[model samples]
Target: MTLMRQETEEIPAAVARLLSSAPETIAPVAAAFRAFDPHVVVTIARGSSDHAAYFLKYAIELVLGLPVASQGPSIASIFGAPMKMGHAAALAVSQSGASADIVAMAKTARAGGALTAALVNTVPSPLADSCAYTLDIAAGEEQAVAATKSYVNSIVAGLSLIAYWANDKPLKTALANLPEQLEKAEALDWSFMLETVSNAQSLYTLGRGPTMAIAAEAALKCKETSVLHAEAYSSAEMLHGPVSLVNRDFPVIAFAARDAAEDSIVEIINGVIPKNPHCYISSDKSADAIQLPFIATGHPLTDALALIVPFYRFVEQLSLHRGLDPDKPAALKKVTVTR
Candidate 1:
């Protein structure tokens, strides 16, 4: 059994841990958000953590109507440039919480008059030390070079904070039931899409709204573990120039949440069916595309996180099928510190 597979199965328990500890761990962050009430929000992260930030970007903007943006850590880590972030809030995410660039960016956000917080696995690490509040994702120690439980927990932490801050009863209720939903997600089989891409050199992942981050994370995992080149695009964006590459047999995985975007995403997937026969989509609604199984977390936001669990399981198997080790990808490290 590879570490990646082990960690992927641990996602439900990890999420349960984060949820059970939310009252104490996330209360202060929610309180700070209510009190600070910043005009804008900014996120600092890299790689998988950055995809978690993108998920939060959509949640914050859609739920609270506060505009959110991502700040490149290189600005502070390399150029030593100052930013005008007064009256803003910053959210930084890292599993290890030791990246110098992320730490520097968090420090810069604080110095620029922002209320900064972090979601990290290691509670007392440098990035956590630099923030006003740090919520431990509580994913335990992930041994896989490709992150699974940590990424899911990071988004859960962010969504929990958003739920409390916005006082969204539906979202809060959905989050309370998330552990079970995530467990259901783990059992879903995406092997049809896996078999389709098992021999392909490249593929395209499509999604809209918060699930776009799921698509992005899925694409990254394909590259990291399966050694396949996968590109992520919004269902709308893929119709532009990217679809030109799609032939009758080109593989495409569309992540369609059971939210407002579901109909549109299904429509787009149906549109692609003429050009690509290997298109697989995850949604309850049917289309010309192949239907991949998914769990419908009661709330739209939590639905996004649920989709990744099955994908993680699929990617782990796909990697092994491609003669690669999912536990250790090529040219990668567990903790990457960039400055």
Candidate 2:
């Protein structure tokens, strides 16, 4: 088996480990967040980590009712601008905790008076040092360049932190049950997408709210592992302009979690099925679009997060089917440090 496939299978256990040790690692960060009580939250990350931030952004906004923004690392690393973050809190998500610019931005956020925290797999790395609070995501050594477990664990860490901060029992219960759900998620069959993805040159992924972030991550994984060109769009935004790109030959996968937006997503999928018959959706509510089985995590937020596991499994198989190596994508390293 490929390293990517092995790592993908390991995700359930990784998340379980992270959740089991949450009190020792994540609780302190949650305490800090509760104490700070910032007016706004800003996230610092890139690539898959950035996608995790996007997921957390919706979670923070919907649950805590605090607006979250993505802060550009270049503000400190390139332009060297002084940020006024006195009323803000910063969350930096990194798998390696070694990116130079991410480290710089974390330092800048702390200096600028934001209650800075980091969720990282690498415990003693520079990015962790830069932040006032650091929670190791505890995904273990992720050898695959595509980052299956680390990405999942990063989001899990952030969600756990949020749950502790708000004392949200329901969210906590959902998280406690996430490991079993994730195991089922890993076992799900998404092989139907392999033939379509292998044949197609390009496709679109659609989601709303937290699932939009999952869609973005899915698109990136397609590009990274299979060398396929894929783009992610919000179901709402696709109607505006990108819907013009959808045709009979074009494939679309809409990720609809069991949330307030599920009905709207199903409607969007129904609208697209006429123009593109090769469409798939995660939610079973869609009658026309091909339904992809998903593990419902009870909470809307975690239900979105669970969608990625099967995608990871499918993409790994797709990469191998295309005679490509999922672990070592062309021109991509495991740990990218960009300034």
Candidate 3:
């Protein structure tokens, strides 16, 4: 078995380990967030870790009503620009806490008086040391260069901290049940997409709200594992310009969680079906598009996060189908330290 597949299979257990250690690892950061109560939140990350931060950006905005923005590491590392982060809080997500640019930005945020925190797998690394607070994601050593469990656990860790900070009981309950839901998600067969994706050189992924982040991650996995070209677009934005790219041969996958955006996603999928017959969606509400099975995690936040596990499983097989190595993608390293 490929290391990517093995790490993908270990997602549920990795998340469970993160949740089990939440009180000791994540609660303090939550307490700091509550006390700081910044008007804005800024996220610092890149690649898959940036996708995790994107997921948390929605969660923070939706639940806490605080505006979240992505801070480019280059602003600090490359251009040496100082940021006015005194009234903001910063969260940095990374699997390896060794990225020079990420660590530099974290230090800049801290020096500017932001309540800075890090969600990282490597505990004592530079990024962790640069932050005022650190929550170890506890995803263990991820061997796959494509990054399966570490990405999931980074979002899970951020969600746990958000749950604690907002004192959201319903979200906490949903997170408590997420590991089991992830197991069910991992068992689901997305092979329904294997043939379609394997035949196509490029495709589109669609989602709304929190699931938009999932769509972004899905598109990245397609590029990293199968060497396929994929772009993610919000369902709300699909009809504007990107929909013109759709044709009979083009494949589309829309990820819709059991949230307010489901109906809108279904409508968008139905609209695309006439232009392209090879459209598939995760929700059962769609009329003509093929429906992919999804495990509903009983909360909108977690429901969005759960969709990635099955996609991870599918993309691993898709890489093997294309006679590519998912574990060792071309021109990529396990830990990317960019400055």
TM per candidate comes to 0.98, 0.99, 0.99
* Tens digits of per-residue lDDT for model 3, 1-339: 989989988999999999998988788889989999899999999999999999999999999999999999998899888888899999998999999999999999999989999989998989999999988999999999998899999999999999999999999999999999999999999997888889997899999999999999999999998999999999999999999999987899999999999999999999999998899999989779998999988999889999999999999999999999998899989899999
Q: Give the TM-score of candidate 3.
A: 0.99
Give the lowest summed-lDDT range of ten residues in model 2.
Answer: 192-201
lDDT of each: 0.92, 0.93, 0.93
Worst lDDT window (10 residues) for model 3? 192-201
Instruction: At residue 193, give the lDDT of candidate 1.
Output: 66
On residues 1-339, what C-alpha lDDT tens digit does candidate 2 reach at each position? 889999989998999999999988888889888998999999999999999999999999988889999999999999898899999999999999999999999999999999999999998999999999989999999999998899999999999999999999999999999999999999999998778779888999999999999999999999999999999999999889998988876899989999999999999999989998899999888779999999988999989999999999999999999999998999999999999
Model 1 agreement with the true structure over 1-339: per-residue lDDT tens digits: 999989999998998999998888796789888899999999999999999999999999999999999999999999999988888999999999999999999999999999999999998999999999999999999999998999999999999999899888999899999989988999998876666799787899999999999999999999999999999999989878998999865799999888999899988888888887898889767557888888888888998889999999999999999999998899999999999
Model 1 misplaced stretches (Cα beyond 4 Å): none
